[model samples]
Target chain A: MRSGAAVLVEALRQEKVDLLFAYPGGSVIPIFDALYDAPDIKLILPRHEQGGGHMADGYARACGRVGVVIATSGPGATNLVTALATANFDSVPLVAITGQVKTKLIGNDAFQEADITGITRPVTKHNFLVRNVDELGHCLTAAFHIARTGRPGPVLVDIPVDVSMAKTDVPLPTEVHLAGYRPHVEGNLRQIRIAAEAINQAQRPVIYAGGGIIISGASDLLRQLAEKSNCPVTTTLMGLGCFPGRSPLSLGMLGMHGTFYANYAIMESDLVVALGARFDDRITGDVTKFAPGARIIHVDIDPASISKNIKVDIPVVGDARLVLEKLVELVHFVERRDWLARIEGWKKKHPLTYSSGGLRPQYVIEQLDEAAPDDAIICTEVGQNQMWTAQYYKFKIPRTFVSSGGLGTMGYGLPAAIGAQLACPGRRVIDVAGDGSIQMNIQELATAVQNKLPVVVCILNNGHLGMVRQWQQLFYKSRYSGTILEGNPDFVKLAEAYGALGRRVTEAKDVRGALDEALASGRTYVLDFVVEPEENVFPMVPAGEAIDRMIGGMT
Target chain B: MTESKQVISAVVENRPGVLAHISGLFASRGYNIDSLAVGETENPLYSRITVVARGDEAILEQIRKQLAKVIDVIRVTELSGQNFVERDLMLIKVNAPAAKRGEILELAEVFEGKIVDIGVKHIMIEISGPEQKIEAFVELVRPYGIHELVRTGRVAMLRGVSGRPARAAESGEEKKSKN
Candidate 1:
């Protein structure tokens, strides 16, 4: 017989989880104690539960594996709520093992008791509460299976303290038997044929790929389908890097803050093959006017995602990679010179541009793109920095760009960078963060320093919530209410205090040098680049307006 | 695409938090559950949940799809347009003075309600019928000063179905055609 915590560790071993991002607390002492004896799984303690949760999410996104995070009951589990929601929105596979109070004291308001399972129901894909040690192994196995399977998202397992301490001899289940949980992997053959015919016949076809392509590891398949059909490809922000960003056929991104040519191409296209991409409001602009002349073929794993926003002409529900494999085989080559020429004209007329002066964020991103290694993974905090990185940085490979796309979580970058670095030890990891967003989870700097993960965080320090300020400037007559980041800490000193390398670069010429030096430091480094404050992202579609109605970026 | 009441029934794993998961999905998606009822099915491991919601065709499609996506939900069937039978159970307490006792009993007999309990000045009646009938009975008893009323939302099943109820999967094609 073994303790419940020992069985939990054994279950983790069975799942081949080598790295555990966890925070210790009162309810989880038994599990922590078990970890003391278990040397195979490395425990990287995070300063906060939320940071640890993001780390797990980042690890999952970086490597195609289920990330695991553990936290204690009550406040510790509650702290992970934001991270769970973020991962859920992005569909990242993560298993969060949280400690709960003893079963008998669960509803009696015992010390450190929390209804964590209740709190996380809507955010997580699934969750469990382990009532006994006999079922602990099964729950853990099920949690991991649910988290990593089709349409991957976070799953939480709350193990009561007494359950963890109880003795049990039941072996962990190797396979899950969930009758209600089978994901549709192979799409209907008729639907695939219909989609292929639509693709083959269209004069101007565009492939609008999203993060699902990367999640399903269908980037290569996506490229094949796009190339075979001679289609121009555009990606959403999360879908960046799933296709070669610098390719001639690439339309950088679509939706709000997308490239002028990409948006114009999508609007003008006769066929829009949406692969693993949802037509989000940010991308669709005014839904009634979106893709006015186009017949849409949407391919996704989730049936619900199809025709949820924009009406899909051909809906194929299956794994993206599997569907693309079949689609590439069926789709025939077609060339329309007039369509390509029109897109090229738009690209030349309204290229993504910024006024080149005073340490612009776009300039900084371009410099980082140029200076970083080809395979370096770039994580980003939300707001202007995220938009800038999406706009300026050319991600050549899949899994190289990571950001909180769905939830737009601000503090996601630093911890995510750490997780990415851990996942890809040989690759350089950098967090391109805005000053306001970086401060939200700055405490994770300690996690980076202690782990000796050489993650670089380049803060585009504008001393304000730049994105909100831009919206205020454009829509609210530049009142800038509560957008200013007053009394910001000196980031360089903050890095020094955390025993990490720090640099403050104020000039455009110095940006590349700082990035190079920081990448080579072999220590957690912080680069504070004081970028232009009032700069706004361009080719912007004001909310609820048509995609073609641009506010700026007309060269 | 006008808004109408939609009845959705799902077979789900009989687990601790399955109800919460289903209800939470509805609440988070901004779909109001007009009525909801859950009970164990013939199989002990599974429970049947019947939910009535008000939405247009698009909203109804979304609700069905979202409900099917939940891990615990085994199958989802929309019973609104199909030939189905639905009943809601209600236990209502009303003032039963000596003078009004005969009238109340007469009204109960008309509605096929059974007098479950009787107090000195109150009568407890149990009635099971379609939602409209329940509402009608409640309105009729209101003049008698209803003391308390509780209902077990609604439970529905398709008529002449032996194996399994027809799934809402066919509606996907219907939705596409309408679009």
Candidate 2:
């Protein structure tokens, strides 16, 4: 007899998934038992279901593969919602498996039964309900295929308890056919040729690369294009890891908090070739004034993404790796030294810097980075710490920077770090958090301590909703409405309360030492850096305005 | 006939102001909806809705975009090609209605469709192709009056993809409607 749980495990193994980040529950007891005996696929028990989901997301984004998460039905599956939404917005591929009470109990509102499929319908690319163990192979194959293809997003499979327990003769699917799921990977040669000519003739060309560069696993190709053509590159927040932060042509995150030089360069460039970057509102502050002089060429893997956000002069519909390779083949390297010098002048004249006021926030991240051991993965909670880490951290390789970009999910960092640490067992995972946002997923700290996962959580304790507060300061006249955060948990005691190491650092000198010691200690550590909450990230562009109108930078 | 576009924004309580209400409005009156997009706006307490419907050039400017201005609504913009932008989602299944199966499959292939389920009498095709293709395929398959049709109303991004990105520099509504 083929048990549902066994069948599911068999199917996952067939898909070549070696690991599952998950939390067990009453409904999924059978699957848990099956996992206990399974020798091939390792299961990581997340402290929280939300963390499980985020681990999947982080893994997917980090590895550029479909991340898998397993949870029990009802609340267990419900917690996966935020991560699924995060993946959907960011176009990350995740396969979430949730165990239901039983198929018969569906619609009856049985104990621990929630229509997770229905709940996740809009947010997920699609979902499935396994009625029998017999369908496990087909269902899993479809789940992985859907999760990993075309504008890749999250997919859910809700397996009933009975289905997981009931046995049947296994009939593994050797092949799966989805007539609807054909994703066009090869570049349309006509569009490619047209784009090549545009680039071949461009006087002042710029390559605006996005996360697709990393997703396509074509950083080498992107670097080749940039170096060969001497094309200056700008990236969205998602595209941060694509170009080396130290590269000469690299212009840092270009959007609401983007560099002044990056935005100005984009606006003034005669040619803009967008690779996988969605022209988000935060990036295109004032669309009317954005790249007005540019002849735009957009190359993307998703057909829907083509001209979905920005108007295209020449649209190349293909994967970035394939498309970039072809373009490099057809075109010769050409650089305007005069133009490169101009951009360098802008970069040199307007280099990014932060002042160490009464309390320096930038110092906190630096300290955390210094303290963190080599191969330590930093998962950043959204808001100021997230941006600061993105700007300041030296992420030398892929999967190193794991945080929410598309969704700007505030609670993602702590749980995502928990997830990443599970994947890379040897690496020290740190969650650089803002005190305000940390509260959202602070429950996971117990997970970290319980699982014996040594996560060095550095809380940049700025006592306000710092990002929004900055906006209100710059644009809304510092009315200081609801931005002030007060009467929060004593995090030091809180970490100790959870039986973990915790510390509060008020001075800059103490921060590095505290972090270094914490990282050196094997147990989960929480360092609450009492940074001056009033400091703001500079070069802020007011919404609905031109990017060039960035305020607050000395440059 | 002269045509004008209306932009109507609505703030609906997130509970159950679903299709039944929207359908009741359109079914009760013969108002054709050109485009509609609904999402949680700045505040999660309410959903912000923007619809661009075309018709009746002579109606009151306030009245045309006013249907959504009911108590549930907090804002409105009866947008058009000139002032506003709109996009809609369509999942269409044209005739594989018994007689011409293979030929219809070829057409469906051209439109990039999936045959979801097949019956002796009809085949249910799933397609997220262009609206023009949907309309054209529906008309092409119309010797067999369509059995069922459902479309998510249009969501608009003002001219360009991003709000502050350069405006689309104007194109035919039909051409711009390609997405």
Candidate 3:
């Protein structure tokens, strides 16, 4: 015999859940009491439920494991919605557990009841409401499975107060039997052959990889494919670390903020082999003009990704590793020496360059990379800083570069870095945020400082939302609309207010000084680098266009 | 986008509250179903549901993911290009009086359909097919009025492969025998 709360702990243990980020609440005291004795499960109490959710997502992304977050129902659950949506969009596997109102009080417009499940349905991968204590085991199992399955995302399990208080036998479910759910993990054979045929036959083939390659742990396979086929490779922002950026065959990154040579090669290639990448507007610029002459082979783990855009000649659906292994075995290696030489010449002619005289975002990223511990996790928020980090950071190891790629959500880095820090305590984690994006979730600093989470939030305080302003400057007739901050808080004062250390950097030479001081603080800290205004991420391909049409200072 | 209808099969837990979650999800998302069917699964612990609707690719993806997220929902599958067995049972009232009753009976016999009830004016008949045939049959029976009738929701499976449960069971049995 076990209490409902005890059963919940045991169920989580049975699922091999090792860590949990949580906040206590009125409706869920029983579960907290049960957690006191479960030393096997390490629980880190976060200052805010929103931070807990993000931390969970960061842990999941950093560790390549399921992240668990718990909160009392109502406000606790509501705070987690944005984090859940962020996780859902980025495909990070997170489990958000909330304590619900008592069963009888659930639909009676209970004080804390705001239809949490309804509010989160569109954003979360799935959600559950546990009515019976006996079904808690089943629900827990399904939540983990759903969270960590194909193209993993967040799942919410709303446990009512009574359900967590009632007693039951608490037998662990033997297995899950989901008739409608079967993830296609194995590669499609016909499509795989078609891909191999396309690769072997193409005259000027290039492999455009995405974050899926990194998520699938297919970096080695991707490199082998590129090396063996003598194909040039470029990656999306999220696709960093899938290939060695320093490699001779590497085209760096291809997108709005991609290298000019990379963009040019992708556009001019006769055959484009896109692996684990969605041709987002940022990457493709204008879809109609994207790789118009190239016969495309899109290989991804998700089926719906195939031919959804850019009508693929061959669409291989399966794990990139599994698919690439088969492709390597079937196809003979051939070198496109002429194509490679031509690309190298093009790169030598038009390289990714920035103004050498001014305080540059790229300079900040390069300096941070040099200052931080080797192979440290650099999480970035969306803006000019995010693009600059993507372009400049040299990530040698896998899972080192994390960001909001698919959703382009702002305020992602601070919480994500906190989560990443919790995931790998010994490793350094840094959140690179623009001044505008940082304020969105600046409250999370208290979450970090309260828990002594050694996460560094480096704020590129450019005064205006860098990315939005850049778009306005280029396309919006330079009429700034709600993009600039009126009374920006003294970031240094804000950090001190949150019980965290703070630093300010105003000079071009002080970037290294600010980064070093923040990292050395050995506590939750902020380094407000007051950067130059009117800076823009360059080598941009205008919307719905090809990479060849890149226009910027560098291009 | 030509709005071609789609058949989605969902497996959910067999419980009274499961329907609330599923129906609530569909309602909140403003997704309307053309026909929905729910029945107990081969495993008594669960139930299998099939839904039919018309939507484009993005909507189908949203629906599949949304269904998969429902707590009681065990699995979700959108039967797209995969070779799968699909069927729907529809009851139509044919205009069969004494004179044309023989012809209607012949047609029912050819299609293996049964005429459940008959009146002085109309005959109630049930027919099933792979959507296309069902549409053709309905068109042929259009000479008669379709009275209040219900169609079992679209149920589907991959064309030539074993389902996940069966495969898992076989693996489990293999391990058991080895032990």
Q: Pick the candidate with the highest lDDT.
A: 1
Q: Model 1, A1-555: lDDT tens per residue?
A: 999999989989999999989998899999999999989999999999999999999998998799999999999999999999999999999999999998999999888888999999989999999998999888888888888877999999999998989999898898867767778888889999999999899999899999999999999998888788889999999999999987888999999999999989988989999998889899999999998999999999888998999988899998999999899999988888899999999999899998877889999999999999879999999999999999999999999998999899999999999888889999999999999999999999999999999999999999889999999999999999999999999999999999999999999888888888999999999999998888888979999988988878677
Cα error, candidate 2, residue A297 (Å): 1.3
lDDT of 3 by residue, A189-304 (tens): 88788878888888889899988787788899888888888888998887888798889999888888888888888878899988888777778877778887899988776665
lDDT of 1 by residue, B1-179 (tens): 69899999888888888998888888878997799999997767778999999988888999999988888788888998899999999999999999999999999999999999999999999999999999999999899999999999999998884544334322221111100
Query: Top model by TM-score, which number?
Result: 1
- What tens-digit string does per-residue lDDT give for candidate 2 at A1-555? 778787778778877888888798988899889988987887877778887888788777766778899999999999899989998888888999999987787889899888787678657776777887888878788888877775688989899988888887868676676422445678889889988888888888888988888777878888888887888888887887678777998887788788778888888899998998878888888777889899999988765565544667798767888899898877777868888888898898887778865557787776666666545777888898888887677555555778888788888988888777767778888888999889988888877787788888888898899998987887799999998888989999999998899999898778778877888888899988888878888777878998888787654
**Separate DockQ for every predicted complex:** 0.33, 0.03, 0.14
What TM-score does chain A reach in every model? Answer: 0.99, 0.94, 0.95
lDDT by candidate, in order shown: 0.91, 0.76, 0.80
> How would the docking of model 2 be graded?
incorrect
Once superposed on the true structure, which residue ranges of model 1 sit more than 4 Å away at CA? B94-103, B118-123, B138-147, B164-179
Output the worst ten-in-a-row residue range by lDDT, candidate 3 chain A: A174-183
Reference-based lDDT, residue A326, model 1 = 92
lDDT of 1 at A45: 93
- Per-candidate TM equals 0.96, 0.76, 0.83
For model 1, the local distance difference test gives 0.91
Candidate 2 interface RMSD, angstroms, 1 decimal: 15.2
